[model samples]
Target: MQRTRHWILRRLSHLDLILLALVLLLLGISVAVVASASGQSPARISGHLVNVGLALSLMIVMANIPPHLLSKVGPVLYVAGVVLLVAVAVFGEIRNGSRRWLNLGVMAFQPSELLKLAVPLMLAWYFQRNESGLRGKHFLIGGALLAVPFVLILRQPDLGTALMIGASGFYLLFFAGLPWKIILGGGVLAGASLPVLWGFLHDYQRERVLTLLDPASDPLGAGYHIIQSTIAIGSGGLFGKGWSQGTQSQLDFIPERTTDFVFAVFGEEFGYVGTILLVALYLSIVARGLVIAARAPTLFGRLMAATLSLNLFTYVFVNMGMVSGILPVVGVPLPLMSYGGTALVTLLLGMGILMSVATHRQLNKT
Candidate 1:
């Protein structure tokens, strides 16, 4: 009986209980907010539950796998992700004026989701392989690798996902010892080229920026998202309108409330105080991730963990900024709090990698 119990224990994931519990709590919050956003639609709520369930299961499976094995898989995953991005550019479906999804017969999905993990892992693996003697050209090669996917995703016109991917790669590169001179130079160059880049933006994308600057310019058009979301948030005050009692959400004034703008629903229903707690929860999760990154024994583990943690931070920051009328709405979801399968799965997969990094080190020590 003891032997059988031991075998069962061996098969279980070495999950960081704190991380697991925090994410689960966040997921729970997501369901409640999604319920309010969807007006308690049973189908939407049930479908969201299915997605969360499936994503959590994947997270557990990924957590059990060691970082070394993930390192070996990084290059292959990166290659596949790039190939799919190219395929998406060539034969992807056009939805909401963006060619981001590829039809796989069984189901259609955005290929760019793969890059959320592949980019960081690939760069970490690359730097680790060349760790003994790194040089400028190695950074160049890594930049080139990062650029290919970025350009491909950019061509798909998904500026949000593309920029997020770019940010993740930048995080990985920075951790892999990318020099600050290049970072500064690149920033200056990017600023100088803003006029040139503006021409490349889609009309709607350009309008989003314009509306962000002055939401009243097109109150019923491009400016609607910011105007409505801010109203919802402000109306909530200290304790919020009380869950489903939010006027903006219940009346359907907010767009994309279940996805990109879910944070608005949260802000309205929970208020400033609620949002504070939410931010604290998010910070707690990031704090745990930083601990894991700091403690990981290998460069690959450390870089990957740090990148994932910061990427999650990016999600929270960008989404809040968008909803609060501070930044242009880039359609970034609010991490585990938003309802979506692809992004949710990608986030969970990254957390799984973090768990592997956290636990496998202890396993080796034992």
Candidate 2:
């Protein structure tokens, strides 16, 4: 028992306790909500448990790695990710009108998910190399680097992932001290191109934006999701209706209740107090991530850690906003709280990188 205890303590000596605790809490809540929302279906419950285990394992493995090694491998991973994405575009499987996955003999996977990590890694590597000479030209080069994968993803018509990936890259550039004038100018240009963008959007995408602006316009059609989700949240009141007792979810009024809109089920079952707690938990995780980023020893580690922290914040903000009808429905999942294997693994992998940064710094100090 003494040996076992000592082994465990040494293994977790450099781990971020606050972040890990928050992750476990979120996972627990996810399992509970999924069980309730899914009517405690054995398959769903077991599947989620498996995903949580796998994600935790990935996190642990990543945490043990050093950030210096990750930075060295950044370019290789980025190139591989881009190649896989191109392969996806060329001969990917089409499911539900989108070509976002590649089919292996045993299973299918989405290459776009890899970009979420690779993009930031690659950008961090580049910025670190040119740390003393960052300027407008460098920013332009970074923009071009970002644009290649962004265009391919946009063609896949997965607006959500593309936007998130783009945001990830841009976040790094911004943190690298891209000028405010350049940011303002780019923002103006983007706004001016709205009409061009509107023309490029698929009808369904446009409808979602419209529905976000006013869901009542087509209450039974394009607006159904937002309407039902809001009703479910509103019905929860101060303390919620109780677990497995939410009418909107139980009776099938809520769409995508197990995935993108899972938070609605949580809100309906847990109410205002529960919602507050969930939000606070997410915020606490983000805060810890930022703290880690602020303390990272190297420029690459700092950029990568901070970008991941902000990216996580963006996911929670966008998902909750869409579900609450404050933003357009964009198919963003509710982080670890949502029921999906790929996303959970990817997110935990990023968190693992953060832990690696912390661990590497500690080792250097010793």
Candidate 3:
């Protein structure tokens, strides 16, 4: 028993307890909400459980790896991710009107998911190398690094995932001391280019944006999702409709309840106070990640940890906003809570990187 305990302790020494606790709580809540959202489907609930286990296992594995080793691997991952993305674009399966998934004979997955990690890793590696001679040119090179994959994913027409990749890369550049003038200029440039960008959006994409401005205009058509989701959330009141008793969710009014709109189900079942507590829980996890980033012993570790942490915030914010009718609906899933093996794995993998950053100093001591 003593040796068994020793082995377990040593193996898990890299985990940050606070972050783990928060993540567990989030995952536990996810299981319950997924049950409700999925209408007590045993298959879906079991699959979610399997995903949770797989995600946690990967998180542990990543936690045990040293930050220095990850720094070295970042560029390789980035290159490979880009190559896979090209393969996906050229010879990928078309699902739901987008060519995002690559079929590798025996298995298939989205390469954009890998870019969620690779983009930041690549930027961190680049910035760290240019630490001493940081200049406008270096940021330009960083932007170029980001634009390649961004264009590829956007061409896949998955604006949601593409935006996420862009956000992660931007966060990395921001942390690397990107100038405020440059940021402001870029914002202006983007805003000015909106007319051009609008012409490029697909019919469905354009409808989503229009629907956000006013869902009632097309209540049964383009606005159906937001309309139903907002109703579900509003009907929850203070204490909620009570667990699986949510009418909108249980009656299947809310679309994609198990994934993108899981928050709506949670709100309906948990209520106003429950939603507040849930947000607090999410905030706590973000806080812990930021703490780890602040304490990371290396520049690469700091940038990687901070960017990944903020990236989590972006996911929550976008999903909630989309479900609440405040933003255009997109395919972004609620982190750790959405029901997908791929999404769960990629998200927890980032958390694992957080643990790796948090525990690096301790690892070096031994």
Candidate 4:
């Protein structure tokens, strides 16, 4: 019994308590918001709770694995992700005009979701392996590696996810110490190419951008979502109208109340005070992730942890921005708060990676 206790203490000492606490806190908030948003739908809330539990379990298991093992398998996993994405493009199921899912009898999944983590992991491994001798050519190669999956995803027409995948890879590149001049040059080129990109946008995509510019222009048409969402937020004011009593949500005035627009439901029920507290919680999670990355025992671990952490921040920012009408309406879900198996699984997997890195830090110190 004494020996078993000692072994448990040794393992516990390596656990990332702060990151775990943030994950649990955010998950608890997710359950509350989902319950309110779903109008207290028992089945949906229970499913989400089960998913969160699974995610936490996965995180604990991942935290115990060594960083080197993760790095070694990164490339193989990335290739598998690409193959899955390609397979989806060929024979995947289509829903709502996007062929992004594979129907696997018992469950359906999106390969693009896997790329979110796979892209970062693969790149981190690549950079760490090649960091002994960095060069412009290496940077360009990394950019190409990043761009391939990104272009494929964009062709799948999942712009939101493709952008996220690109962002994750770009974060890895930026941390690998890419040159400032190249970064500036890329920015200028992107700015200059906006016209070309705009020309190629699908009609609905164009309308989304226009809606952001003037939601009132098509009050009852393309702009209805933003218009309704803004009203929900505005009506909430300070302390909120009270949980499960939000008229916007209960009346179905706010579309996607349980998914992409879950934040609106949260804003309506919890108001500004709740919003501030929620944002603080998210920031704390990001901060803790940054700490883990900074203290990571190896370069690959550092890069992976930092990129994953920032990816979470970006998810929150983009989802809130799109829902609030500050940005073009893109179908980005609010992390754990949003309903959907793919996103929930993907996000939890990311947390798992963070836990792995944090655990590595603790192990190396001893």
lDDT by candidate, in order shown: 0.92, 0.91, 0.92, 0.87
Q: Per-residue lDDT for 191-249 in model 3, tens only?
A: 99999999999998999999999999999999999999999999999999899999999
Per-residue lDDT over 1-366 for candidate 4, one digit per residue giving the tens place of the 0 to 100 score: 999999878666556888778888888888888888887899988888888877766766676777888898889989999999899999889988888999999989888888998899898999988978988888888998888889888887788999999889888999999889989999999999999999988788899999999999999999999999988988899988998889999898999888999999989888999889988998898898898899898888899889988999999999999888899888999987788767887887788788788877755455
Residue 8 Cα positional deviation in candidate 2, in Å, after optimal superposition: 5.4
lDDT of model number 3: 0.92
lDDT of 2 by residue, 1-366 (tens): 999999878667657777888999999999999998898999999999999999998898888778877888889988998899899999999998999999997999999998999899999998888988887888898888898889999998899999999999889999888899989998999999999999999989999998999999999999999999999999999999999999999999999898999999999999999999999999988888888888987888889889999999999999999999999999999999999999999999998988888778966455
List, residue by residue over 325-358, the lDDT tens digit for candidate 1. Answer: 9999888999997888988999999989999999
TM-score for every candidate vs. truth?
Answer: 0.97, 0.96, 0.97, 0.95
User: Candidate 4, which segments miss by more than 4 Å at Cα?
Assistant: 1-14, 362-366
Q: Ranking under TM-score, best-scoring first?
A: 3, 1, 2, 4
Model 1: weakest 10-residue lDDT segment is 7-16
RMSD of 1: 1.5
> Model 4 residue 107 lDDT?
88
Model 2 stretches with alpha carbons more than 4 Å out = 1-9, 364-366
Q: Global CA lDDT of candidate 1, please?
A: 0.92
Error of 3 at 89 (Å): 1.3
